[model samples]
Target: MSDSSGMPMTFTTGQMTSLYSLAWTPSTTGGYAGTCIFLIVLAALSRLLLAYRHLIEQKWHDRAMNRRYIMVSGQNETDRERRIIGGGGEKAEEAVLTSKGLDERVKVVRSARSNVQGIPWRLSTDLPRAGLFTLNAGLAYLLMLAVMTLNVGYFLSVLAGLFVGELAVGRYAGIDDNHH
Candidate 1:
């Protein structure tokens, strides 16, 4: 069978246990050089967009905390406080008596936990903004599928994309910064 573009359509159900396949077809050209380069660039951008979505979500979560939004389930203030201070090495007491009021700190921590847990649900339910989360997830799944193609070059391309994406968002996401 051929697609509307007159390109022969192909599908396979065989087990994919490797990372090498010639399944991807570029829209522009069928030549290996053109298609491979296109797929590589597309994969890289998709991964970058995924990373950018994560950065956006992180910022949103922080904003939600600032708004004092809490979504914890079956956890009370004491539980939250314990979770926060229990990991205190030696300055647990000092950690408790910071500039911010105890209640305020507890609220922030609770909100953060809530944001973490509710992210999936919120992404599906919250309109417009949910698009980012959905896109991130879709890109992740697509990247996985691309890996299943088992093509060494495709696998390398996906890996390169992920690495580049991380580098692009690392500073903005504060991934390497100590958050204590």
Candidate 2:
């Protein structure tokens, strides 16, 4: 068979064809194999980006929780001090950390469900997340286009890439199973 350019189409071996664009045309079997490998790596890279975005989100959450803990813990300590000094009958052991105090801290930390810096959501904190989302989407669409070539080799390569990528990074990607 022949394409618009009159070059003999290599449908069987999936060679001698253009993929995605003119620049991606592979003229030989070896070139086509190389292209397949490139597609696999590119697909895997998209998963890596997803894992990176997850890491950033986790870090932000931890930071915000730590900040809230500090704020709440300090306030609790001050209140305890006042109660002890004002009453003067309570033992020094009352100043020790208790389960109730910890419960209060946890509650305070969980209540603030806003951005990393506490309440004010800024574009600066969101830019990296947005950029990664765009990049990951672009890579996914690029791989889809490659598969649209309907070449058996390219299709399998994309599938293998996704499997390998998930094995490597999907666990840390923080995708909830219930969402699926």
Q: Could you say which candidate leads in TM-score?
A: 2
Across 1-180, the per-residue lDDT of candidate 2 in tens digits comes to 768965545534447657888888998888999999998998888778778888887886665444422223445555632211122123322332445642333122222556544544548657876887788789888988877676778888888888898899888887652211
Query: What lDDT does model 2 reach?
Result: 0.66
**Top lDDT prediction, candidate number:** 2
Which tens-of-lDDT digit does each residue in 1-180 have in candidate 1? 546954334433223222224354433323544544555666666656655655666777765554433223356756543332223334332334345643323222333456456454454335646786577567667777766555555566677765665566554544542211
Model 2, residue 84: what's the lDDT? Answer: 15
For candidate 2, the 10 contiguous residues with the lowest summed lDDT are 81-90
lDDT of each: 0.50, 0.66
**lDDT (0-100) at residue 38 of candidate 2?**
95
Shift of residue 169 alpha carbon in model 1, Å: 2.6
